[model samples]
Target chain A: AQSVTQLDSHVSVSEGTPVLLRCNYSSSYSPSLFWYVQHPNKGLQLLLKYTSAATLVKGINGFEAEFKKSETSFHLTKPSAHMSDAAEYFCVVSDRVLTGGGNKLTFGTGTQLKVEL
Target chain B: GAGVSQTPSNKVTEKGKYVELRCDPISGHTALYWYRQSLGQGPEFLIYFQGTGAADDSGLPNDRFFAVRPEGSVSTLKIQRTERGDSAVYLCASTPGGSRTQYTDTQYFGPGTRLTVL
Candidate 1:
């Protein structure tokens, strides 16, 4: 089974400070990882994805995640946090489909980011 | 260019009633997925549809939960004998499946339908 675990349920950071959200995964095969953000009552927005091609993946809104296969980790990071960055973040792993189509995503218990001024 | 869209933005139903949630995927997307999200947890996959057929339904909780994508563009999730535990946000997403030329298989999500079973 492929699964992802978000280390923090909530993270608070002041504006202009650095931000980091940690995630760990367990997978039987090489995994495709992703980070998605959700605002209140809104749809999920894809921030970034790691597809084995790149160890360091850059995403929308200045967010990035580095996939470390040795550690089974894909941690999201941002150098400077903005107030608008306050949202819930989810770490997802793709479980391979046996029928040779798109894989189903396994999501982590989200992390709520609170950006303060 | 429209993103995925789900109908009945909010639904309030009584226990033991039946309900149907609809999803209209983005134009030309070949894959559609349904998920259920609780108050604080991430979305849980319920089913996956490729074209007009369900490629995977293993995530469905029980026999009362059923879904169909007859036309390959729109999908409907039907739940029978709904319980209070089924009260949650039902989300739909779509992606370009099995496209080798595409760099990423990212799924685009809809705003989601909030279901409340009282």
Candidate 2:
């Protein structure tokens, strides 16, 4: 079984300040982690994914996340927040390919990022 | 190049009514998945298909929900005896399928169908 937890339900940040959205996950096997953003009335867009490669994974829109096995966390971060960054973000996890191909994803409750100008 | 597309952007039905949600995946993608997101929650897996066969369906809540991808492209999710608790955003996603890359391939998602069961 796999599950994810986004520590924050909502996060407010100034436009030029750093953005941090915390996520933690648990899985019986090695897991693949992902960050996805959803704009209002838009599709869920993939931001980044960590698949047991480099611990630091960079994604679109100046976003990135680091996988910490010791902490069971994959927290997303950005250097600066933009007004366009206001959206609901999800932290997702999946088991390794050995488990039913690992296509079934388990998602966190999500963090709503509010970037203030 | 097109992303995933879903039909009936909004659906409202009374209790016990049957509803079907449709999804059209990106061209050439061979994997399709169904997920449901309740208000204030992230999407939860429902089922997945590789080609025309359902590879995993353990996430389905119960027998009331069923999904099909007969031609390996277009898929539909059917809900029977809908209840208010069943109302939520039904999401569809797809990814390119290959034994080597299936685990790491990104899953592209559709805008979703908002189903409201009253």
Candidate 3:
């Protein structure tokens, strides 16, 4: 079993401020993690993924996440937040199978990000 | 021709009415998935199909929700006796099968079909 827990329900950040969204995971098997963004009235978009490769994964929109196995966390970070960054973000985990054969994604509840200008 | 497509855009129905949502995956893509997103919530997995067979359906909330891919291309999700709690935006995604490469694991999403049950 694999699951993800997003730490914040809502995060308010001023424009140009740093942004951080925390996520933790639980899995009996090797875990493949991902970050997805959903803008209002739009479909969910993939930001980044950690499939047990590089510890740090860079995603779209200047966002990145570091997978810390020891901490069981994959926390997203951005040097600066933009007004366009206002959206809901989700953390997802998948049971790692060889060659990404097992691709069932388990989603977190999601964190709403509000960036003030 | 470019991305996943879902029909009806929006649907409003009375309780106990039957509703169907359609999805047209990218051409030649062999994997398809369904998810439900309630207001302020992330997308929840409902079902997934590999080729013509459903690979996983454990996330389906109940038996009333069923999906089919007759020709392994266009699919339909049917909800029988819909209830108020069933209201949400239904999203469909498609990817390549077998490999977890960028084109396969990276799913292309549709705008979604918003369903409102009164």
Candidate 4:
């Protein structure tokens, strides 16, 4: 079984300050991890993803996450938080590879990032 | 290019009624997914379709909840004897599949349909 746990339910940070949202996982196989953002009344947008190739993944809007196997974590980080970064963030994990073209995702509960000015 | 699209952005219905939600995935995308998000929670996978066939339907909550992708590009999630527990924002996502890498199947989500079962 594979599962993802986000450490924080809500995180508040001032604009221009650093941001960190923590996530840990339990997967039998090496996992495919991703971060997604959702604004109020909007759809989810992929922030970044970690496949087998990369450990440190950079995403749009200056957000990034490191896939650390030792820590059992893939924590999203941004050097400078923007007001626009305020939204609900989700950390996701995929259970298995596609026998042919498998691309399934299981999501964590989510963290609400509140950026204050 | 246009992203995935779902119809009837909001639907309010009485309990015990039947409702259908629709999705039109990205052009040329071979894989589509349906998920439901309740208040204050992450989206839960309902089902996923590969091409015109359902590759997985295990996530569906109960027999009353069903989905179909008959022609491959479009899908409909049907709920029979709708329950109040079914009220939530139903999301649709699609990926251009053919590989296992997340890049090959990075899901593009639609705005979602807000279904209210009263």
Each model's fnat?
Answer: 0.55, 0.69, 0.34, 0.47
lDDT of 4 at B111: 98
| lDDT per residue as tens, model 4, A3-117 | 8999999999999999999999999987889999999989999999888787899999999999999999999999999999999999999866543455667889999999998
Question: What would the per-residue lDDT of candidate 1 be over residues B3-112, giving only the tens digit for each residue?
Answer: 99999999999999999999999999988999999998999999998899998898999999999999999999999999999999999999888675332488999999
Best by the lDDT measure: 1
lDDT of 3 by residue, B12-35 (tens): 999999999999999998888899
Candidate 3 displacement at residue A21 in angstroms? 0.7
lDDT by residue (tens digit), candidate 4, B22-107: 99999999988899999988898888888888887878999999899889899999999999999999999998876646333689
* Candidate scoring better on TM-score of 1 and 2: 1
Record all residue pairs in model 3 with backbone atoms less than 3 Å apart, i.e. clashing.
none
| lDDT per model vs. reference | 0.92, 0.92, 0.87, 0.90
TM-score of each: 0.97, 0.96, 0.93, 0.96
Share of native C-alpha contacts between chains A and B (below 8 angstroms) recovered by candidate 2: 0.69
In model 4, the fraction of reference contacts reproduced equals 0.47
| A1-117: candidate 1 lDDT, tens digit per residue | 889999999999999999999999999987889999999989999999988897999999899999998999999999999999999999999857635465788999999999999
What is candidate 3's lDDT per residue for A1-117, written digit by digit as tens? 677889999999999999999999999977778898988778888999887788999999899999999999999999999999999999988774322243667789999999998
Model 1: what TM-score? 0.97
Q: Once model 3 is optimally superposed onto the true structure by TM-score, how far is the C-alpha of residue B34 displaced, in angstroms?
A: 0.7
- lDDT order of candidates, top first: 1, 2, 4, 3
Task: Say which prediction, candidate 1 or candidate 4, comes out ahead on DockQ.
Answer: 1
Better candidate by TM-score, 3 or 4 = 4
TM-score of chain B, candidate 1?
A: 0.95
Write the number of the candidate with greater DockQ, choosing between 3 and 4: 4
